[model samples]
Target: MPIHNADIAAIFEEIADLLEIQDANPFRVRAYRNAARTIGEYGREVAGLLANGEKLPKLPGIGADLAAKIEEIATTGRCRFLEQLRSQLPPTITQLLHIPGLGPKRVKMLYDSLQVQTLDQLARAAQAGRIRELPGFGEKTERAILEAIRAHASQERRYSIALATQYAEALIAHLRRAPGVKQAVVAGSYRRAKETVGDLDILVTARQGRPVMEHLMTYDEIADVLSHGDTRSSVVLRSGIQVDVRVLPPESYGAALHYFTGSKPHNIAIRKLGQERGLKINEYGVFRGDERIAGETEESVFAAVGLPWIPPELREDRGEIEAARAGRLPKLVELKDLRGDLHVHSKASDGRHGLRELAEEARRRGFQYLAITDHSPRLAVTHGLDAKRLSRQMDEIDRLNEELEDIRLLKGIEVDILEDGSLDLPDDVLGRLDLVVAAVHSHFNLPREQQTTRILRAMDHPHFTLLAHPSGREIGGRPPMDVDMERIIRHARERGCYLELNAQPERLDLTDLYCQMAKAEGVLVAIDSDAHTLLDFDHLRFGIGQARRGWLTAKDVLNTRTINTLLPLLKRTM
Candidate 1:
């Protein structure tokens, strides 16, 4: 079986989790975690490189020992160290880490004190009121744990769009290689660019069905095949992502794509329009009293119902059909529109690359500018910069600007929004920078009113420029902090600051709804890749997908403007 980057990353992540739970050396645990991130986001397949007798390229956190381990996993498909760690503890205890507030330390404490090793065990302890009696956990924390447990139990397993893309793209490319295959595309929610996808729906037009199905069954990563037939097959990948592939004739391909690439409500609305027009629309074809009329292309299907083609991101039955009818559909923002990334980091903080390397990559991406917003002093874990260090960094930026060509680097800091609603860096220091990206690094559990007020107060600072990762939610890891988002969006409009649509896979913050809300209030949304490494810029495509879903056009985004136009806007906010 072939090993992909995600597979290797998962192994390293598990090693880190188990080591942390055992109270192992913090730096050792951190090394594995960092290696996992670097490999996971790497643009090429490490396994493939090794297979071709090519050396693994030098990465930031992967040293000699880690490189050997990567070779071990790539060649043998298992990590012996991880297996040994699993033997030393109840393997299931790692699942406890999935709960929002439960870190490895808390899990270790719970196990040592009460012998709690599973969700059911933890739930029983909480229900019996024993968890509150523990030293660190009180009634409020106990209640939140119980609630998180319930939510975790009820939730369906889903993959982040980034991870799903890896599996989907590889499979589609494989299918396209089969003889007689014409078109292959992944439809459904993945096509709609949802943050999470449950499964994949692939539609292919082929000269013959049997050869395509045979090629699919031979896919190296297949864990199990659920069904197989002449025209359709269903299989689950080793990563636990289910995929259904259907082979169709060229004539009915478009109608089938439209039907399968759907939000159920949107399909119903289109069908209703077909009904009123005395036509029948479905996966097979568009028919008028049993005679097929329009099924050759998606545009023809839409024309049959008297509407223009709708972008897949907007086909959620969210007033898109009506807008298409009125010819008011937006020219949704594309990836090419972005001029630069606003919230980025460097080795001075937690980031991987140096200033010149980051600039070279940004220039290669055709960006006019890239802001280097390293962390402020409050996040000492990241080796965040103090005022004196920040000034020195600013001076460095001035020198780089004089020597660099095409790409200009902006000086900035991701200053923490402190608990008392103050910026972490003093106002005098903040005033000297080109931009100040205010963020909430800690205190994620404050009351709704306090949280909102804290952010609002931070935005009011004279030097505040943009709000980074507004909600501070990690897709499956942490619940979004409780705050009044509407009030925040309106306040950004009033204060002339912008909200970030963070493009990191886990933290696609300022969700589609919030983006729409900001647009309604005449506030620009900066679709930024809060990139810690060079490869992280690829995440901008995910942000663009999210922006289109929110009905954002090029004009609604902050970073779409060139440096000449954007610097003026940043000055107004400052």
Candidate 2:
């Protein structure tokens, strides 16, 4: 890998610390630290120049003095000064730098005060009364330290979709009821209905003028007021959630909406185009020499800039504007396009409803078909089906299909992928079901190389019609298991196995980029809601927008087909 600015700057800083402890030349020590900071804040990667054999000194922060030190370090595995420092302190002490309040100065204090190294040791020393005895430490200080450590350890990798949705719902509802509020919406990444949301953004129009800003701060849940002004205000909620509310004039509502609902890259690209056309873009309005030209609404912002209206999800500035400019945007699929739900549960496994009840509900939603996919036997907690139960579920599906109206029920199983690259359900058992969704429920932390091979092997199994939520990620709780999405999607396409765009907000797997790429590669995707409860069925809207972000259309999705047309694909012979 080429050395990025951060990568080089970090190494340089290490050199500086080592020099201090090594008792090396003073100027040499200062040069490394100074250069490291300068390069780090440069805002771009320097890896590109390394490939071209450009000397380091040519880059910012690399003066002749610093350049010599870099050359010496790169040529030898051991930096002479660093080696000396390594002998004096336990290397693990460096990790204390990761804690927000505990910088190197505080780290040195903790070391001298209690000789603590790792987080566990530090937490213990603080708790055992050694830390609070120090000159600057006290009960409140120790408590803060303890909380920081706990927070760091439990730093959520992602937020659950449900949690984000709840916050958005409350904020939107509250703002809508606020006096003078004409229209309010949860915009930004949340508005796009993303699987994992980072923040909650609220946009509103106010008729009562500047006083509306004061009313917003009155809510009891709002605290840690960040910034409050006429046009904008922000506060951190008690739940550790940040809510940003922007008040817009009704006339500039659309323009303000477009600016706030940003995919930064998309915004950058649009602004670049505006600059080229002698126009300016901002939240106030898109302007020509201070005379407001367009931006009454989001639609006009795009029209003013000579482009078609782009959806919020596609605003990521990731080829979306180009696609819009070319009029080649994918005819995105919608919730109405979904003809059936391919991965659903019933009383056969852990589902709340029974087989007949599930089918009837699907029919009620105007679905032409519904697949009752229960967990296989390995998932014991879910009442996973055995050979006998699988046979019964299939027979029940047949019986129910005979009694149903326009809709038909498909029998399927979500079989576990075993460590040995085999499905939990045997070939004989799998052969009986109309469809099979193979998933990985255990051994999530397997190395990427092994996990990819493992899932690909299961997909190669003739019975696996679809790979369910291939990443196995739950919003904010866990990172996706290390599997190559591009590799897995390609393997499934080659084997004629569909990849599921699981509609569950927490697991909108095969994200927008993967969705578009998969379509380009001729892979058939199933927009399965993976609905467990009746209300969870509403997640279809998020999935549809996600699919459209990937540029999917009704024709590109497998589940959008009528039940009659879907049956043949479920069989092994097809």
Candidate 3:
């Protein structure tokens, strides 16, 4: 089986978890976790690099030992060291780590105290009132753990869009290589750019359906073929992602694409529109009394119903159908419209690269400006900068700007928002920077009103410019902080600050609905790449997708403006 970057990352992550549980060296554990992140976020497949006889690039935090492990896994499809670590721990203890609020340390504590190595074991202990008797876990914590266990069991597995894209694109490429396949593209929520995709709907226009279906079944990554037929096949990939491939005639391609790439509500609304127009629309095509009227293209399908073609991101029945009918659908933001990134990090903080390398990469990407917003001192784990250190970094940024051409590096800090709503850095230091990107780094479980008030107060800071990853979410790992997003958006409007659509795959904060709220409230949202490595600049596309899904236009995005235009805007916030 071909090992993907995600696979390599997963192995490294598992190793880190087991090592942590064993109370291994903290630095060693951190190195593995960081290496896993670098591998997972890398733009290219490490396995492909190895297969092509290339050396692994000097990845941040990845030393010789980790590199060797990556190559071993790539070649042999297993890591013996990880297997060794697994042998020392309860085999199922790692599954406990999947439960929210249960980090490796807590899992270790639970195992030591209650001998609970599985969810069933943990649940039984919790029910027996045994867990509450433990040192740190009280009655409330016990109840929360029990509820989390239940939630974890009932939840259907979903892959982050970034990881799903890796698998789906690889599979699509594999199918397209087959002789009879004319076109193969993934539809459904994947096409819609949903944050997490439950499964993939792949549509292919092929000369022979059987040949394409046969090719799909032969894919090296497939663990099981659920069903197979002339026109359709379903298979489960080793990653646990389910994919259904449908082979359709060329003429029905557009209609089928529309049908499957659905938010069911949107599809139903579109069908209702077709019905009212004396036409029937479905996966086959649009028909008027058994005669095919339109289906060859998405534009044709929409035109048949007296509407323009809707972007997949906007087809969520969130007034998109009405917007199309009125010709008021947004000219959604595109990746190319961005002139800069507002939130990026470098070696001075937890980020991997130096200023010069990051600047060169930004210029290579045609960005006119890139802001370096490393963490504030409050985030000690990131080795965040203090006032003195920030001054030195700002001085370096100034000196580098003089030597650099084409791209300008803006000085900034991702200052933490304290619990009492004060900015982590004092006003004098914050005022010297180009922008201040405030974020909530701790206290995620505050009540809705307290959280809302805290953020609103933080935005009131004189130099506060942008809110990075506003909701403090980690996609699959953590739920969005409970707060009134509407009030936050309105407060940004009131304070003249901006919001961020953080492009990091795991922190695509400001949910789509919240983005729309910001749009409606006249607050400009900066679609920022919150990039840590040079590869991270590529994440802006994911942010752009999220912006489009939120109905954001280039005008609604802060970074869409040129530096000359953007500086004035940033200045106003400061």
Q: Considering summed lDDT, which 10 consecutive residues are worst modelled in model 1?
A: 85-94
Model 3 regions lying over 4 Å from their true place? none
Question: Model 1 scores what on Cα lDDT?
Answer: 0.94
What residue pairs are clashing in model 2? 158-476, 159-476, 254-296, 254-297, 254-298, 266-317
lDDT of 2 by residue, 280-327 (tens): 999888899969988778888888889988888788777888888999
In candidate 1, stretches whose alpha carbon ends up further than 4 angstroms from where it belongs are none
lDDT (tens digit, per residue) of candidate 3 on 1-574: 8999999999998998899888899878888988898898888888889999999998887889999999999888999998898788876898988787887888999988778898999999999999888888899999999999889889899998889988999999998987677778899999999999999999999767988887778899999889999899999999999999999998999999999999899999999989999999999899999999999788999999899999999989999988898989999999999999999999899899999999999999999999999999998889999999999999999999999999999999999999999999888999999999999999999999999999999999899999999999998788889999988898899999999999988988888999999999999999998888888888888998999999999999999999999999999988
Best by lDDT: 1
The alpha-carbon deviation from the true structure for residue 554 of candidate 2, after best TM-score superposition, in angstroms, is 1.9
Superposed Cα deviation of residue 1, candidate 1 (Å) = 0.9
Q: Considering only N, C-alpha and C atoms within 3 Å, which residue pairs clash in candidate 3?
A: none
Model 2: worst 10 consecutive residues (lDDT sum): 41-50
